[model samples]
Target: MSLRALLVLVLLPLSGCVPRIEVAAPKEPITINMNVKIEHEIHIKVDKDVEALLKNQSGLF
Candidate 1:
């Protein structure tokens, strides 16, 4: 091949090696806020009535 054609072919691939860059700047400060609430309740029951036992035991003494 001719020297001119060979030089053109070699330089074609070098054009793609150039780098590209982009930059951005922030204009305001960032802020975040969060709120949470929790609630709990419990209930219990006796196997036998407690008031009747106290009443029966009072007469035994």
Candidate 2:
């Protein structure tokens, strides 16, 4: 067999593997739902002799 004919036969089988692409259009609106929750932790440290009071008015004398 000739070199040209052998090369043609080898390349002919590869032509069938060409990619085929397709596209489509949407008819309705796409809906997406995402639910997220965040939690926070707070810690406060005070002196050992200091007292915690909301309203202290006994020192008015």
Candidate 3:
């Protein structure tokens, strides 16, 4: 009979409606293509005595 009661009764049904959300994966699988080129260089330094040993073509190498 009151205005507040009437408003509550009118809006009560609207509160029952909840939004539904769905998440689905794609039918086709995902593919990742990597065309990568890697280049590297190494530098070694030795003492003068070891360098002389290697230059002499010792069997150590």
Write candidate 1's Cα lDDT for 1-61 as tens digits. 9999999999999999999886867778677766767777876665466766867699755
lDDT (Cα, 0-100) at 30 in candidate 1: 70
Q: List the candidates ranked by TM-score, beginning with the highest.
A: 3, 2, 1
Cα RMSD (angstroms) for every candidate in the order listed: 8.2, 5.4, 3.2
Q: Candidate 3, residues 1-61: lDDT per residue as tens digits? A: 9999999999999988978899999999999999999999999999999899898977875
What TM-score does candidate 3 get on C-alpha atoms? 0.59
Q: Quick one: ranking by lDDT, best first? A: 3, 1, 2
Return the clash pairs for model 2, or none: none
Query: Which candidate do you rate higher for TM-score, 2 or 3?
Result: 3
Q: Which one is best on lDDT?
A: 3
Off by over 4 Å in 3: 2-17, 58-60
Which residue pairs does candidate 3 place in steric collision? none
What lDDT tens digits, residue by residue, belong to model 2 across residues 1-61? 9999999999999999999997977889888887879899998776644433322544543
Runs off by more than 4 Å, candidate 2? 19-31, 52-61
Cα deviation of 20, candidate 2, in Å = 5.1
TM-score of 1: 0.37
